[model samples]
Target: MKLIGLVRSIRALGEVAEQGSFSAAAGVLGLTQSAVSQHIAALERETGLRLVDRGTRPMALTEAGHVLVRHGRTINARLEAAEQELAEIAGHRAGRLRFGSFPTALTTFVPAALGRLRTEHPTIVLTVVDDHMQGLVPRLTDGGLDLAVVYDHEALPAATTGPLRRVHLFDDPYRVILPARHRLARRRTALSLADLADEDWVGGHSGSAWFRIVRHACRAAGFDPRIQLSSDDYRAVQAFVAAGLGVALIPGLGLVSPTAGVEVRRLRAGAPVRRISVAHLDDEGQPPGVRAMIAILVDVTSHLRRAEPRRS
Candidate 1:
């Protein structure tokens, strides 16, 4: 007999042993009386035993039937436990979530969102990693991560290809960071990119997306920025600007707590903006934990946007 049929037959036999009749077992198992009788007959044929005493008014299990029913009870119990576990996972009561995010986001709204998720779904196991967008995207596609928060500049949009989908979170606008003592820092109005064309620029590593966006924005202003120092760390970049090394462009999300001695100003025109998004695989349906995390992230970002200062 096929494995499926064998399992079903065993379950039907066990139900008949408990209920005392094929008709009663059919009602309990949600099968027709004929179907239950067929299952029992198939089980008896497979075992070469007369498992049921059909001469009795109510069914009675023979020695072989009693032994098989004992095993069937164990199988039914295990199947029930497995179904309960799956249901809990589907309902977000328990499961594992592998999540990822970029550095700035990790330091900003991501933590708050994660904290809320933990509070709401305490049984969910969370594993988080911080990496750049380039690193995060590949992990999402390869099934290494369940969800990730990533960003892309207007100048260079994210390549969200191949079984991945993204939901936009918010736009992180770029602000020019100048040394507190610098001439541009004293200006009351927003500074144009052209205003800093002749100044030395502090930026991200040479080949990074951040650096590329900076270069793109500078070129749009008709001048290539003279980047004198480079660092991936936003704090270090701000420190470079503070020490009068050069001016730099930092995103709003990256300036959670601005370091001392730097003046952050809005761009008068042509400011580069990073589009933040939460990405996941384009599966048939997202797991409940993943869906909950996405919702928390959106709420966190909404509160952050509202709390941000109106002025640059």
Candidate 2:
């Protein structure tokens, strides 16, 4: 008469009959032993059948209980097969790679990575989206993305809870951007954080991840940087540095071309590094396409490391 009652009874009955002990069944199910006993008692009461003989040493199940247990196992197995078959059809043999990434990686890191993947897997489809770490974490959890490339920094705001796994790739170091005429620029070598303590600085918008990285790196070198200008755009930061206004900390990940007159100097001490990682939800069994994309990503990083020396 009661569908919910019957389902619960079947599950409890299957557990108790399989383990041969109410206490063992309850432990496996994370329920109290009394709850398991109560479920069995309720089943017998509702069906007007004696399901278990409690006087037996290892609690013998009656004929009705044995029948229900056998049928219950079959039902559970069929349900599992249905779900797995659906997932395989939906995800398997799909040539698409749904990748999410932040801006810095988008500028260069991902493009270079994709170039390498193309040579080996030319027919594989790739879909890429750019979003902040805070925005991407939710989409990753909700199944909107297959993988995400992100930069981890201590000062950045944390995202809400999500089911995902992070695979660390590498650390991208930050360099100081200065005018071609700055005294440190004439030195023709990387300058230490201590060497720039008294220098004026151009920075990103207040409370931005880059701003925090610059602030912390400076403080770690025993001085607070003087911010003369603030803007979120890297080009804007470059413009400020080019005019001899101030120097700013820039990451090496995307620093390919010069900014007309802007120059870059490596910071010897407290050269802040941002961690790059790939994120994906832990599905029970991953699809082949997902596995291929992961392989491509790892290969890309390996190739870049072996290439010519990059500007710090």
Candidate 3:
């Protein structure tokens, strides 16, 4: 039987016992008298017993009715508890959020968002996975993650299709990181990628969006970068650049706490810009916990953007 059928049957039985008449119970349940009578009849047919003593003026329950009414009370209590638990989850006071993020996000914005989530919803458990967009999107599609913090560096809006819903957070600009002694290192203002054509580079490892973005941008600038090393970790990338292995591109989010060895400067207009965003299955029928996590993420990113000093 459907769950709603059972719940309504139990509700009808309990109301009839409390109110002492089908009409009164129907009024109490906001159902028609015929509907209340039909529910009792259905329950009686299911249990193969007479539930009401029809001979009485104000109806009294039969032995079978009394027994079923007792079970109805227990079911009512359980249903109330379940409703309260759902309410807590809806309020973001309890439940879990399975979140996925890439490395730079893990190091920067993700942690900040997690901190805010903890403060606002201390009872909410979080399961975090670190993976690139290629790996994370599939997991999200398969229902493995409640949300994924992904970035689009190709200067295009996130695709809107299937179960995926993309919420654009911010445009994270990429910057040039080079050793202190490098030529053009003193150029704190916007610098062209073509200027680094003859420069060896430190790009991110394969299997990451950053790696592909760097490669594509350099090729667009009319030269293929001779990468000495590829490290997804920005700190390590900075370390390689500091040792004069090569210049590297680091996102502005990663520049929150710069490494000591390199001079971080803005890339010229039309440089690679990453759109940091949160992607999740369409939330139309999702649980409250998923919506709660998304709300917290939006709030955290908003505050960070407001607090940050805009650069030229």
Best by TM-score: 1
lDDT of each: 0.84, 0.76, 0.77
Runs of candidate 2 exceeding 4 Å displacement: 1-95, 116-125, 160-163, 303-312
Question: Which pairs clash inside model 2?
Answer: none
lDDT of 2 by residue, 161-252 (tens): 24468776777888888898888788877789888888888887777778888898888789999998898778878888999998888888
Model 3 alpha-carbon drift over 4 Å, by segment = 1-94, 155-163, 303-312
Scored by Cα lDDT, where does model 2 land?
0.76
Ranking by TM-score: 1, 2, 3
All candidates: TM-score = 0.68, 0.64, 0.64
Instruction: Give the CA lDDT, 0 to 100, for residue 48 in model 1.
Output: 96
In model 3, the worst 10-residue window by lDDT is 154-163
* True lDDT of residue 18, candidate 2: 76
**Residue 66 alpha-carbon offset, candidate 3, angstroms:** 54
Cα lDDT of model 3 by residue, 1-312, tens digit: 577797789789878888889999999999999999999999988888999987887888999898887776656644543564577757845566778998778887678778877877777777899986777876676566778888765522243122478887777878888898898887667788888888888987764677777777777888877887988878888888888889988878888888787888876654677777888877465655567777877877896566443543
In model 1, what are the clashing residue pairs, if there are any?
Answer: none
Residue-level error in angstroms, candidate 2, position 55: 63
